[model samples]
Target: MVKIGVLALQGAVREHVRSVEASGAEAVVVKRKEQLDEIDGLILPGGESTTMRRLIDKYDFFDALKNFGTQGKPIFGTCAGLILLASDIVGQESAHLQLMDMKVERNAFGRQVDSFEAALEVKGIAEDFEAVFIRAPYVVEVGEDVEVLAVVNNNIVAAKQGQYLCSAFHPELTDDHRMTAYFVEMVEAAKKELAS
Candidate 1:
């Protein structure tokens, strides 16, 4: 079975852990740099991007986390996590990870009070997936390699680029496990590549 790690630095760590487990993968909460070596894939949970970034720097796991990406393992980011993976944050001067070639606008959906749920037609999933948006950041632009997965209110919310996957909505907050299952499939594929 594939082992997946959710960055436990901040945010909905337990929820993501449950989601990964529901997807039939061994879920681990990643708190230290060494823990990244043990997981087949990683999930950056939805939380305050600035806070998460500060915690990452304090733990001195910034470079280690980025290096983990270089190993070609899948990394999925949700909400503020999406902001971390983005290469650009519109109107913001700094960014975390900068792994995905996309421009994201922070809190594009307004404040926490503006949070709402909607079913979206994701490209890979057969049916509409329930998406929960809370102070989410939407992709304003994508690079050549990036594939837009799902959109809502004319905003790019779900996107994938090679081993990287991002969503402006929190999937762990809902009962649907399709997104996590989709990610597990990506992890399985990457594991196959390594074995071959």
Candidate 2:
């Protein structure tokens, strides 16, 4: 089976692991660079971006992740994870891998009180997914190859760059598995090519 990892340094690690298993893949917690090497893809769970960055720096896993992405491994980032995947960020100063070609504004929806759920029309998802936004970020701009998948109030909140998918909401916290299923398809495709 293809192995997928959850960046377990912080955030909704268990939820992501369960979601990965529900999607028919092996789920592993990736706290170190060595753990990352064994996985075919990764999921950056929702959490405080600053804290996650601190852990990334402390663990010395930033460059290793950048290297992994450069090699074309897939990554799915949610909420704060979306912030890390974006190539640019606004509002607060934070460390990022500068991967996706998008500009994101941290806490774009206001304070924690602003957190709410909305039925979102996301690309590749057959039905509306209940998007749970908790201090989420939204994309202000996207590069040529980055496809905007979903938007809320005209602000981009979901996007995909090649195999790297990102959402400014916590999909792991919901019961819906469409996004997880889509990601699993990505893993399977990647595994197929590798096997070939």
Best by lDDT: 1
The residue-by-residue lDDT of candidate 2 on 44-144, one tens digit each, is 89999889988999999999989878877889999999998887887655539888988999999988999999999998774589999999989999999
Pairs that collide in candidate 1 are none
Q: Model 2 scores what on Cα lDDT?
A: 0.88
**Best-matching candidate per TM-score:** 1
The superposed Cα distance between candidate 2 and the true structure at residue 63, in angstroms, equals 1.0
Task: Write candidate 1's Cα lDDT for 1-196 as tens digits.
Answer: 9999999999999999999999999999999999998999999999999999999999998999899887899999999889999999988887789999999999999998999999999998736899999998899999999999999978899999999999999999988989999999999999899778
| TM-scores of the models, in the order given | 0.98, 0.96
lDDT of 2 at 106: 91
